[model samples]
Target: MPTPLTPPSAPHWPAPVARTAVDATVALPGSKSMTNRALVLGALASAPVRVVRPLRSRDTDLMADALRALGTGVAEDGSDWLVTPGPLTGPARVDVGLAGTVMRFLPTVAALAAGEVAVDGDPRARERPMGPIITALRELGAEVDDGGRGALPFTVRGRGLVDGGPVTIDASGSSQLVSGLLLAAPRFAKGVEVRHEGPPVPSTPHLAMTVRMLREAGAGVETGENVWRVAPGPLLGGERIIEPDLSNAAQFLGAALVTGGRVTVPGWPDDTVQPGDALRGLLAAMGADVSLGPDGLTVRGSGTFPGVFQGLEADLHEVGELTPVLAALAALAATPSRLTGIAHLRGHETDRLAALVTEINALGGDVRELPDGLEIRPRPLHGGVFHTYDDHRMVMAAAVLGLAVPGVEVENPETVGKTLPDFTGLWTDLVRTA
Candidate 1:
């Protein structure tokens, strides 16, 4: 039985005060979304897929469930997973929670089924983009309902003899559209070659994650990080462990920089491929005592930072996901700073650029919205009701800001459950005291 997930309304926050420096070691969770996508891809591969550290998050869990529905044998061995692929006998039913990954990826997962597979997700997930992939699937002869303007509540019929074709996907909304079709292509009678031409493809790193997982699964894929080609090939089971999330590391890094806290995030991959590493350079510019250790990095925030310039200027194409937190930091800075290369922020959990402009300005900040990012001048943020717009990142962006400013309250703070259900507890180790 699947329970419907209605994001509790936008949350409100409490006022925060400048806290004394705290030091702590945080055990960040594996990226649930990444792990699940990799798991599904691995199930369709040709090697003994061994996932190193997979996510137990809600979205990734949905991916696992979907895999089970397709008859893949997946089990956990200590901290790793051994996935054994089986032929998909679907026409199955899938329920994806508010996880956007499941909603997006399941359509392709549907393509691997023997008959029609009905995939449903949380209302929010349902509302997200599926049209591009749905349309692509139809173009590839997978018999799917377009849902009128690129909507969901559709079906994928994988009867037989369906061959991949040349199709242009409107990836302007999500790069997952491209990844889903790419991964599903190899299973088609013929392979799929994708052409991307919208919004320049957001979070290309995430797409890279998908491609890497596909490669590990014995998929013959060719793409220059964006455009992709997947051909029919042998897929088998293997073992794998996911890398620690670089996105979560950003907040801890910001915490260390904002409050001079000493935080250690172990379990980091040495050959990490996440694009969120732009934080290191950003923190250094903001005047933090930062260094990468053999295990992880250490950041010590000294208030005497942000020497001259009072701000920073950099195109964070690589670390676009961290824009919200970085925007918060810039607003809390001594002077104005501009962030660019984030036009795609508009399409995230919420219209991030608009949300940032509205919320920060509402709190008496002299912040302006950019086509790509935010231009924030030093402004005192007072305690006011800030909404999360049912997006986890917004909640965290506000929470991070709350730590730096007095009277910054975040309502409906529980939306972090998408990935971090225990954030409030996690931060209690260093927040709200002194």
Candidate 2:
């Protein structure tokens, strides 16, 4: 085998290995998806809305700043955000950063503003897919200037009212396309009817989340086969509470499964449309005992040393965000694993499928890249420098590997700030307490 990789070229973080089975109660930050959705709906609400326990991270901060740029007031009232609607005027610049939600969701909001709003982001943000949203916007009667490129670094000229009605597009690459339109539909002159006509929309649960949140905010939404209708109406935003980010919770729970330890994530919702909730079944199938109670959800190892659970045969299309952690677990499983239905991951913050394969194989693991997914043959993983590619999920996945493998360094460890600013510190505490 190739020699273990030395430290990376730049600042690297040493991932700590677990000395014992981790037994910690982790309280995660609020959901990024729900926080941004609340921000959008709160901005469009007829009255000031208070979002309780919202996540404060780079992605959510960007969303709040974008709304503030559009003449809304987003102030911190304790851990909540009190969003007061204002005249949607702009001549403002919206820094989308690397946030897919901000980049995809804000343009439609800006279309309802009076002046011009410039939307741009990190260099990688410009390369991400934005054509679907842009095309649908123009069809809905909005003036968007993109300098001939369908991607970001564009400007949306707002006439203060979108003439929304019917539009069709392929939303296979990302679910943000449909969610973005529905979010801005309430402010449109005629509401919106979106028809997704491509490969099954990846992350359908996220779509359901959007629909559920919309209806909860008093908007009329009708869902059909690959179709969604949002009626033009006033959004009644009062006080809304955000659930903990179950996606991020995957990292902590994965730790318990790997160490043959126990972990409880307090405040797990009894009912949620969050895609990460799929972990309950997925982890149980892999031999971890998962239970949901009044306090939250708990996962314990199957009395097997090192928690060598059965390999996974899962389709992670709707929960593609969990692939990195699952891929990491597959690398350490006792049997071979096959994960499918996540080809859409190529369009995420990075080409995740490609990145996972390259980094895992570099660490002395056997992982094959498929056209749509991965086939992992568990093997001994040696310590090495695992590159994160600035993707937050990639960073968390590497940390999971470090639990069993020694001396694994994660490049660009700070990248976890994208979604979970306190990820490293929280992870350290979990390992230390264990």
Candidate 3:
């Protein structure tokens, strides 16, 4: 039997062990990133738009609710959302609820509203970085009252129009700074030109995803060396189908890697700007046989070449979200692995680096936190409570480890609701069938 998932306030939930090699096909939810982006663009369009296979999770739902609060119409049509753009008027309250995308992206949309909007979220949400986007907004001629904190619990005083033009921001903290500005750019009187002047932006794939989606919405976007420009124009509203979340698929495929079995994820997109597309290369480097065909993307493994037999040195700056799963796999690898160029992970849902190091170490594995990444030296892991720190990725990572190592308990297992609410159930079903 699978362990009972605990409530957020519960002490912990024991992670179930897979007694045998896992061999199952798991279908995953729609992409949270794509779903939210589509919602934002749909809300900005002049006519009604349709979003098919939208991820119905905490983050996406929060985005939909926030848009509804801002006078946008988001109604369900079976598995799709029919978004109708309306006059941007608001005396609204937005609860971002620890969703970084909502917190970062919606502020720009809110600035286009005609009234005051107050935005806040979970206590931890207040600690996440927002200054870069906020400062950039103020510089771009929007009135925002952050009370000098530059984070959340701020009020946006919108004047119904933004006098947007060229602006420069330090996006070293996050690529969302540029994306947030660009998403709202097309509505600006002068459009917007954004220049980044700081460390190399982490998660560049996410930035590209933002840009591609904007272009598809009929927005003119020019992206070059560390700069992005969007011309003011009407966003053409139409139907869009969200791709299955490859980031979540990584966890299932990683199960195959660790268990020496095979797992195939259907509906894998041949081309996508999702940062998770990097998984094909990353997993292949770890010695899995990865094949993408008309049927799906299949990852096959056996004991002969299980995980990176030799240690891996990888730069995950563009795909930092995959760090937790990679870190877990590295712990069980035959050789040590060094993952670098992801210092920005320190600013994610939790300080992911610190959380990974602590949780893995607590389970008797050797993982050292680097300033910019992690060094995992393979070690035999036992079982103990793995603290999730309210991060959905941490919950999934711990479940992956539990497949091989018994008695691993996961705290805040409910946190997976943020992105993959049915994570535990899907994992249990797959393991049982295997």
C-alpha lDDT score of every prediction, in listed order: 0.71, 0.92, 0.89
TM-score each candidate.
0.88, 0.97, 0.96
**Per-residue lDDT for 113-206 in model 3, tens only?**
9999999998888988999898888888899999999899999999999999999888988888788899999999999999999889999999
**Which of the numbered candidates is closest to the native, going by highest TM-score?**
2
Writing each residue's lDDT as its tens digit, candidate 2 over 334-433 gives: 9999999999988888889888999999999999989899999999999988988778999999999999999898988888999999999999999985
* Candidate 3, superposed: residue stretches over 4 Å from native: 1-11, 303-310
How many angstroms is residue 317 displaced in model 1 relative to the true structure, after the best TM-score fit? 3.6
By the lDDT metric, which is better: model 1 or model 2?
2
Residue 209 lDDT, candidate 1, scale 0-100? 80
Clashing residue pairs for model 2: none
Superposed model 2: Cα runs more than 4 Å off:
1-9
**Cα lDDT tens digits for candidate 1, 114-165:** 8777777655565677777887888887788655756656667767446786
Candidate 2: count the clashes.
Answer: 0
Worst 10 residues of 3 by lDDT: 1-10
Give per-residue lDDT, candidate 2, residue 187. 87
